[model samples]
Target: MQESHLSAAPQRTGNVIVAVALLVLMAVGGYFRFVGQNWDDFTSLHPDERFLMQVASGIGGPTTLSYTDPAGLTQEQADQRALCYERYPATSGIGGYFDAACSPWNPQNVGFGTFVYGTLPTFSTRAVAEVIAGLSSDQSWLTFYPIHLAARLVSGISELLIILVVFSIGLRLHGKWVGLLAAALYTLTVFSIQQAHFGTSDPMANLFAALSILFAVCVQRDGKLRDYFFFGLAFGCALASRINLLPLVGLIFVASAVRLLPVFARGVAGYEREAHWTQSAVGIILAGVATLVAFRLLNPYAFNGPGIFGLTPNSAWLDEVGKARYFISGEWDAPPNWQWIARPRYLFPLWNMVAYGMGVALGITAVLSTIVALWRLVRGKPGALVNAVPLAWIVAYFGYMGLQWVMTMRYYLPLYPALVVMAAWGLA
Candidate 1:
């Protein structure tokens, strides 16, 4: 025992050192992305950020309205603001391209798609911008960066946390070296790097998904009630961050159920010893309840449901639903002769994302994750079933993403954490 303890100490210390180093590296990467680029990045920011900025700015006419004074605008400044009201974020010359449509001001019909990612984050940043916007001393800081930068920083921090989660999950499954390897690859992944400096729900959802999977692992290993409850909360937050998490969360519950099934086989005898499966079962129930509460907490509009959901065809959520329907059908809006079955489109997008985004080495980990997970199930090795938690996420999520008709780098961000974890497992 003494020899084993002595041997483990250096490894533990190494894990700690690796964790700290990776944290600094990921943070610096995120920070530099925001601060590094000297050129006109404001115009290059995502349309979603631009839209949320206006909603928070009291200019875009958000349905979930909160009124603010053009807080710091001089008469001329206010007049210039009026000129750009309901217009694109930045002019075309800089980098801004789209002439985004303006939303009608209605507090009641804010829609599921709008607030699902949370009204609070954008509102908070906007409030900060209003204060700075009102400042008479400096005009340069008055632009969208004050508010936009906050959102980006929040996302950047979330990405950093995701890197840590990937490292931790990998370490749990394998050894410190592999964990470090997986995390190093994740930090440089294309999708992660692209969204690391942008402010939006994608990173938030990605972080929460990582948290959910982490907590699920805890529940599997220890069968602790809090782990189950925390897992539920994390999954719920993922949902609130974006509806895209729905399928992922569903798989988690299914995996949890499968993990707990042996308890049923064990009958009352399984309740003996140090492990308690019954309480863990209760904890899973609490996870469901917690999910509902958290969803409503983050986006109260979700509580209204159905007819009141998006309110109109032009509402943001209604528009999203239409897209989803089109997505499921896998059709493009091209002429009939130009169109085909189209499901194949989502596959290449998934493949290209994994191939280029993760780079050749780590991307193979993602591509092979499904095969390894299935092989583990077939082999029935020690901890093979325990691996199901992450496997559920890996298999279901990639399948879900691969079938969708539309794709983008941001859309692929959620897969990075799981990819790294599974890659670590595969390598081990």
Candidate 2:
């Protein structure tokens, strides 16, 4: 039977190859669609790249504490810091928002700053900045062009890492061919290419999401403590990068705790392992908290006390500045004439809309395939439901969609690799 499975591998490989080719073609198409709008402009505004430049300039570096005045920052500093915090908040280790002297574009409207743009009193931006700050020590290297270049190099490598991780997950769960297909599909997917190139937190966030899935599977396969540690680390990184992932981390904790419960019921062996589990859990929580504190100490809000999470109004400081930039003049808000209702209609034309609306169709296929695969695994189907990682992915997607109405294409990008793999399995 094993030999037969091996024999069938080549056919699977061909399907994956075709799928990957199609995905790559799509990415090339997307690149042409959006990249032409202003490749350099978009790249410059890339949030992560912007932060990297700030880090290079000592905006949020190791010595952030020394430069900041306990007496409260100057109006110039406050204004700049406010802008920085709106984009990149302060954290424990990383200094207060830097790179005030630089920043060609403000994300107030045309940028991805709306949902998360607040003063430095929050965790999400600061948490991410701390991790980035910790990544480098030499404050001088954080300049825009230099850091942008460095970010590209690092992000490119990270993209490859994502590919490898995806492949490994596919291989372990499905087969060599499935792994190849997923990797190939990922490589060709325009959405992956676009996000991977952008230095925003999304790519790293995607990496962390994938890591959670990877570790979850590993735990299912072997129930190893090391795997759980990896899971914790991945979850930590995810939260550190984007707090939108906190729910996913919560799922991991619950899932892992459940996995360990039966063993704990058996006693010593389970209890002995408890310390290791505790450490792993602590590591995740601390990575998040420590990042927050490190930023807070450096850029303590003038009017507020120490807290990693809270909200403070910027209107006071802005009012004092005599600067309307923070007000209607320079503010970035949804355009008054902007029609949110027609967004989906504008995105997909009539015929394409019908086809693209096929998320429902694709979703139905995924559900049926997942059920059949699961049944096969239980009743000894040759391929099994092991290839249905995308089902969990779909669950995450619907959870996001139902919880929030604002669904962007990027939000669904990570799931494509898994979905393609599942589709292949269903076809097989």
> Top model by lDDT, which number?
1
Against the true structure, candidate 1 reaches a TM-score of: 0.73
Best by TM-score: 1
Off by over 4 Å in 1: 1-5, 31-39, 59-146, 261-277, 305-346
lDDT tens digits, residues 1-428, model 2?
99999989987887777567545644543443234323575357755356544443333323232223447566865665555445444342222232212221112111122323222212233344345656876433344444554444334444556666676677667766666656654555455566656555566666767777777666655556667667766665655455455555444444455445445554557556776577546644654454345333332331132133443523432342333232222233555323333444323222221234224454445446666765775686654434434455555554553333333455454455555456545654
Extract clashing residue pairs from model 1: 63-106, 63-107, 72-134
lDDT of 1 at 298: 47
Output the lDDT of residue 83, model 2: 54
lDDT of 2: 0.48
Q: For candidate 1, write residues 157-260 as lDDT tens digits.
A: 77777777887777666667767777776777766766756767677788888988888777766667787788888877887677777776664465557556
**What are the models' TM-scores?**
0.73, 0.53
Instruction: Tell how far residue 271 is off in model 1, in angstroms.
Output: 4.9
How accurate locally is residue 378 in candidate 1, as Cα lDDT from 0 to 100? 79
